[model samples]
Target: MPRFFSNKRLIILLVGVIILVALIGFSLRDRERVTLPEQLIKDAAGVGQEVFSKPAGFVSGMIGQADLLLDSYAENKRLKARLADYAAIRSEVAALRTENEELRKVIGKQESLRAYNPIQATVIGRNPDQWEDRLILDKGANAGIAENMAVMTADGLIGKVTLVTPLTATVELLTSAGTDYRVSALVQSGSGEIHGLIEGYDAERGELLLKRIPSEFDIQPGQQVISSGLGGIFPKGLVIGEITEVTTDEFALTKMAYVKPAAEFPMLDHVMIADRIAPEIEPVELRPESGEAAE
Candidate 1:
């Protein structure tokens, strides 16, 4: 035991190194049974790898999706523009169809009024306050349109011209709730059987009521009623509507019947004006000096 050759501190340090080498060799030999310290190191390394791998995978997925979105942007814009064009085309087609229908109606109306001169008129204005009761037309006195002239649709009569201006005329519907006008009409049943005056309208039922008829006559239903042309205001043979029901009036002295209008009022866009049913006869001027007047 020499002091310099045999140092206790150096001996202890050498033994510690030998023991550390032996432990590492033993751990390698029995690698399946890893020691706690090595197991802890493996787990920490695995956790670090997983943390780094997850972030890398997430970033990669985000970049791929972003590229796809950027590529689709132009295509989406193109699709949107195509949709707008398709919508515009649909609107144009619808407008064309509507115009064709209106034209057809006008033509049919003119044909129906072949006996009388027909003036094609367009509905210009309809006030909501009197939408169903009245309609403003484009034709006026200049077009030979006069007050009390019958206004008709393609199917049948709708109203009568009540007001006329230089360029426009106003029509008062036969179905007007406040209508004071009356039409002389008769039932056309092969024989001139029933005749009555169209006096008022039933607002609830949207029908014209005929009054002042002989209650003794049996006026049956489904009979075709038309203008009698007796008063000379309304023309003859104009189809009004069929007799739906016949009953006694409130006074029980006269007969009353409901007549549905043939015209679809409040939805009309075009109509025909009966310019004149008969030719206007100029009055013959008489002079006082004439032979007939002096004689």
Candidate 2:
């Protein structure tokens, strides 16, 4: 130590060590507040730490938010692509149906009530008050829509056009409470066709009523029900529903069958309007001869 440092230098080093030890002992005392110099040094250090840490925290937060945004964008893009594919598929199916009808005509097949042109349409509006009773379509008179035209979904028949306007048409569903609304329906069984009238809906059971059926018809559950083409509105072979339960009428004279509808009435979206090419028979009106039958 003597060779490395002169006497004066050694003395200065000893003095510096003594001062550092004294400062440490002073800071160790349990005081209420720090000294002015110590407080100043601590404040500067805190400010420096906050300045550096705040920017780092902000940058990290921005990166995390950016990652979330990127993920959401990717998901939305994927969904839009899938929706486009679905729309294309619907268009292709409609085209194929049209082509099939043309091919049938080319083969000179017998014209049947089941043969009709389909007009594609979309459900636009529904009245909350009337809910299952009625709905409105986007197509109207300009689209060749007429009243009494059968409206159906991909699943099966839903209703018929009751009113038409220039740009919109209203449909009265099979579930309507009006007693005047009736559909000529028939059940297809192994033996033959059993005719009945779709008169009302059983709200409690969520099924349609096929009434005025002969008790001897031997109808049972699981038999398919379809339009009979006698109603003059709906074409034949339009799938209405399937039989679920069979019961006797009030007088036990005729049988009534509860039918589960093929089309989902509560969730209608897209539909087709059937335009009948072959003429249907109209109801005949009786005329009094020479006012002899005024009564």
Candidate 3:
């Protein structure tokens, strides 16, 4: 009888739980029929929108950053290319400037040569030996410059052409000590004729000795001397030098005179080539002072 009463209590507890569940369900159905609180519905919608748009905002920010990076990269590449182009242009400008300077010098030399009716040439090279006084020019047979041509500066004669190539030539200067040139000159003081041969004394110092001047001629210091044009090689009346010293001997027929060349050979930069000859002079006959009849 006690067991039956216990089972009856269990059944009553179950029935009570079932009735409570049914009443809760009926209450939820009635609540569904009524509208939700406006504030609560708005709050939920805002939360859902924020959650949905968060990813889109993040994606948009990423796209903007990527675009900025691409733009920056393109700008950097363009600047680098421009810099390279500018560098190339600068190099070209520098080269052009150098070429222009050289051209100007060449033009100046051409004008000077043209004024003197001389063959234009460029000094291409020089002798390596300090003792040897020689220079090579860029003009040669192709330019009408030949061997044995007289080379003179604006001041005076410098030398003669020794060797020539198609486009180049070599000059043998008067300062060369190994050379022997007997040149006839006129004395400025007494209008007397004198003869002298050049000899090299010192190669390094470019010192030349003039030997063989007639003693009867009154050669004085600072007297100008010029070529007599006896050999027909060099033109007449070209200035040679001035007499610096004169030593006369009582027993000797010839006097020794030291002449300083008019041209500074060491400083020779440009020279003229005169191929034209001077006009010939008429012969003069001497008459007797006592009015003697013509033979």
Model 1 agreement with the true structure over 89-140: per-residue lDDT tens digits: 9999999978877997978643222246789987755656873588767666
Model 3 misplaced stretches (Cα beyond 4 Å)? 1-117, 192-195, 199-207, 248-251, 278-295
Highest TM-score against the true fold, candidate: 2
Candidate 2 ranges beyond 4 A from true positions: 1-110, 283-295
Candidate 2 lDDT over residue span 215-244, tens digit each: 998998999999998887678999999999
- Position 166, candidate 3: lDDT: 55
Q: Count the backbone clashes (under 3 Å) in each candidate.
A: 0, 0, 1
Per residue, candidate 3 scores C-alpha lDDT tens digits across 1-295 of 4465577899998999999999789765413122335334534444454455457556766887898897998899889989978988999999997887799797863322112236756554567695667876656667787665667777876777766655556778877764444444565666656655443343443434455666555667887777656544555666777777776534476676667788886555456765534432222222344376323
Better of 1 and 3 by lDDT: 1
Q: Residue 192: error of model 3 in Å?
A: 4.4
What global local distance difference test value does model 1 have?
0.72
TM-score of each: 0.54, 0.59, 0.49
What ordering of candidates by TM-score runs from best to worst?
A: 2, 1, 3
* Lowest-sum lDDT 10-residue window in model 1: 279-288
